[model samples]
Target: AGYNHDADTKAGILSACGIEAGPDDAVNLNNLDDWQEFYNAEIAS
Candidate 1:
């Protein structure tokens, strides 16, 4: 099976990492916020 990353999932990940996403922004791995969010979340979980 494949995994999917949705908005809430990204948000939760960001939250867990102590990072915040802008209201008008979406999570993209290319961006620092998103990258850190993903990294921290992955390690945290």
Candidate 2:
């Protein structure tokens, strides 16, 4: 199983972790659909 959160929620989590988003943080949500796609492709391997 996997976890999912909206962009605003994600930003809050990251901020709490002392991580900030920048220009490199841009995500192609229209093409990729959701966070699970990123997790499976980038993190779950």
Candidate 3:
């Protein structure tokens, strides 16, 4: 099971291109490759 709206996940969404996320940003799920890159950085730090 996974959270559909976790705070950390939302924060990650906001980190995209250093852009601040609005309500609509969290809804964009079209970039698994980019998200995986973000995940890698998150885990490596």
Number of the top candidate by TM-score?
Answer: 1
- Write the residue-wise lDDT of candidate 2 on 1-45 in tens digits: 334557786665455444575222325322233455566679879
CA error at residue 26 for candidate 2, angstroms: 19
After superposition, candidate 3 runs with Cα above 4 Å error: 1-4, 24-45
Model 3, 1-45: lDDT tens digits are 332546667666656545666343433533543665776799747
Query: Which candidate gets the maximum lDDT versus the true structure?
Result: 1
* TM-scores vs. true structure, each candidate: 0.37, 0.36, 0.33
Each prediction's whole-model lDDT (CA): 0.57, 0.49, 0.54
Clashing pairs in 2: none
Reference-based lDDT, residue 19, model 3: 60
By TM-score rank, best first, the candidates go: 1, 2, 3
Candidate 1 local lDDT, residue 10: 67
Candidate 2, poorest ten consecutive residues by summed lDDT: 22-31
List, residue by residue over 1-45, the lDDT tens digit for candidate 1. 334467786677567556686332343422546567676679757
> What is the Cα-based TM-score of model 2?
0.36
Error of 1 at 8 (Å): 0.4
